[model samples]
Target: MAHCKTSLAAFIFSSSTDQWLAAPSKDLSGLALDKHDLEEMSVAQHYIPKRHYAYGCFYWDWVQFGIKKLLLLDTTNMEFSTADLPPGEWSKQGIAIVEAGEGRLGMFGFHSETSSDLSYTVARNKGESPSQWQMEKTMSLDSGYKYCIRDATQRYFLFTRVEASTSLENRLVVGYFSMDIKTLQLQRVYEKQYYSQYQSYTYINFPPSLLSSRRI
Candidate 1:
């Protein structure tokens, strides 16, 4: 597994060892899928390192025409597969997946009308019905702000607010915060202090990844 390239890389993770290893080569089809195919990954865009409760990792497929799909990669056995998305949840433009709590996969989504308020859901890979998602929580932030991680035990997000006016236009404040999603409680985490008034701020959650680019 030694074929590595700047444009492409593959990482192997072992839950038992609790460590990460980069594939010696990225060209092995059985070991890794071509990175080009990731362009079609769903709204979550990139895989964020969270809890791995099973033998593989899960991903969202890009909305095609009007359909979106879930994909899972088994690093343990070197296999790839897809799962069905919870009904109507995929079409929601504002959707996020995160480590909800208790080692379960959590999903957050919003209706077409409100981008700031998101409904929470968790994926059950085992128990009575595996691979099923159940709703847990929902929240709506004040105007000009949005959530970064939805339904997580500790949720973090960014927001923008009209703070003042300069010359003939208004000024805004871009800020970040974390909260207890279940309790609807929040605390200011960070504030940008300065930003473009007319432009909207885009929030991207950059948690550490399940894999590393460096070789073992």
Candidate 2:
């Protein structure tokens, strides 16, 4: 397993050696990133807590001081790199990285508070051409309620709907739902009329066999 810090230093734990080893710095020249943008790079902050893993790499949504990009750590080579977000207005909204199956990376973006469509895009790389993002699917959501993406994993995303209000503190969470990335199925996980001071929520899905089996 590898861990990264703000300084871009990576440390890996080797089970065979039973020790933590520091990974060497990686060159970003081959990544095709602008020199100026590389200088301003920053890792994900506390507000963005979710980390995505796919294609032998771990990804984190990084945005700091107007610099927005995906910080990638390739576990196979123990190197760190960055990938630009998908183009368009959706990139400015709340987005989460997801595995799109078959060694592809997918992203889910909320289409503002008024829009009912949630945009899903996947990265496409063909031949020697640069990788680009292409729209895959747009899942329609209830426009009546305001939704906020809380967390995302391999194939499931956790989101909450809160009562629309001018003040953030006065807003009340009314519904919580988890959406399956593959099936595009929305499952209501929790619903209640309550005020929550917590800023984050985590959704855990257990396999059906485990849920039905008797506890020892």
Candidate 3:
């Protein structure tokens, strides 16, 4: 899967095996959003394995792109659609997608302020109907200054936190935490602290097939 930025073109490569193909590019004339809107912002897409679908977030912010809306792909029907995010003040850093309880896809967004609870918009079931999307749950991540959810499940969730600092430093007082993925209650069970420095950070969870299969 790749995005064509030169033109209003995006692509999906379908093959039985992990074979390469030279797919011809074409403008996204009518798919997803309008052509004019597509030209305005680049799409940052992520594949949700549990749902067998993917979504694209429009790039609007520099440090954290695509904070406003998202474009969704229905793999079962091979159709493109747009969906509105949950109502709340969201940060690019705190915004993420996780597998909520019952293997439902959940849109995780946090409040701008640290004192508030993290918002979660989950789909009612494993279907494409937008009406099924509802406010599933919310939880707190106030253990540290700032936090981001990396992955989640019905039993547990993984996240990282960056502590407050006085001066501009290249390093971050980082902490890794995992807690019971309960409804409105996160019972902490694992945690660790360390200092990490990187040019950029990307949170991703690879498929088990790719992780354990023969290395490419």
RMSD of each: 9.7, 4.7, 6.6
- Model 3 ranges with Cα > 4 A deviation: 6-18, 21-40, 43-63, 99-104, 113-116, 124-126, 129-133, 152-156, 166-168, 179-196, 199-216
Clashes of each: 5, 0, 1
Candidate whose TM-score is highest: 2
Better model by lDDT: candidate 1 vs candidate 3: 3
lDDT of 2 by residue, 1-216 (tens): 233233455677789989988888655444456656545442322244347666677776643324446767778777767777777544332567777876778888765555657888888962112168898988787767677777777768777877655357777788878888899888998887766676665635557666764211
lDDT of 1 by residue, 1-216 (tens): 111232224476789999988643323234233444333232233333222223245343333323344444545544445455455634333345555656666655554433566666777664211367787776666745433332222343323333323322434455555554445466765566564444444333444484344211
State the displacement of the C-alpha of residue 35, model 2, in Å, after optimal TM-score superposition: 6.8
Instruction: Assess each prediction's global lDDT (C-alpha) against the native.
Output: 0.45, 0.65, 0.49
Q: Which of the two, 1 or 2, has more lDDT?
A: 2
Rank by TM-score, highest first. Answer: 2, 3, 1
User: In lDDT terms, how accurate is model 3?
Assistant: 0.49
Extract clashing residue pairs from model 1.
1-24, 1-25, 2-24, 2-25, 3-25
